[model samples]
Target: MSRSVSSHTSPVVRVDDLRVVFPTMDGDVHAVNGLSFEVPAGGALGIVGESGSGKSVTSLALMGLHRGSRARISGAIEVAGQNV
Candidate 1:
């Protein structure tokens, strides 16, 4: 299946300096650090990396799945001009 999108449009999602850290018994696990990117209104982004590269962590952060007390997330995430 295929879909069409407008040519002139702003970014639908924007993430800047995103950092997600989890405190473990050993130490703090830096899942994602200083990650930044933007997805245009009709643009697509693919994140590929080796195991334990924080791909799932980044996705969780974007979806606000991490608990505030369990993980430390510092950065800016904007979707549709609204900060989330």
Candidate 2:
């Protein structure tokens, strides 16, 4: 099931059309694809998924943990009105 938060409140964090891909020897590993979300300033968000479902990769991407050479990330991530 998928649920989305209402855009009534100002968001502290916003992500749009996020995609993270890693090129490997055999093929590309798609960690995240077309993911988008928003977290209000005082609101909390939780992410749940099975193993290897790209949860960690999403977090890493949000925290800017992934090296540019190791992963290809294309999307918009905004925090406090600043694009990250």
Model 2, range 30-59, lDDT digits (tens) per residue? 999999998986679999999999999999
lDDT of each: 0.91, 0.90
Give me the displacement of residue 35 in model 1, in angstroms. Answer: 0.2
Clash list (residue pairs), candidate 2:
none
Q: Local error of candidate 1 at 24, Å?
A: 0.8
Candidate 2 C-alpha error for residue 78, in Å: 0.6
Q: What's the TM-score of every candidate structure?
A: 0.86, 0.86
lDDT of 1 by residue, 1-84 (tens): 877777577689999999999999999999999999989876799999999999999998888889656999999999999998
Candidate 2 local accuracy as lDDT? 0.90
**Consecutive 10-residue window with the lowest summed lDDT within model 1:** 2-11
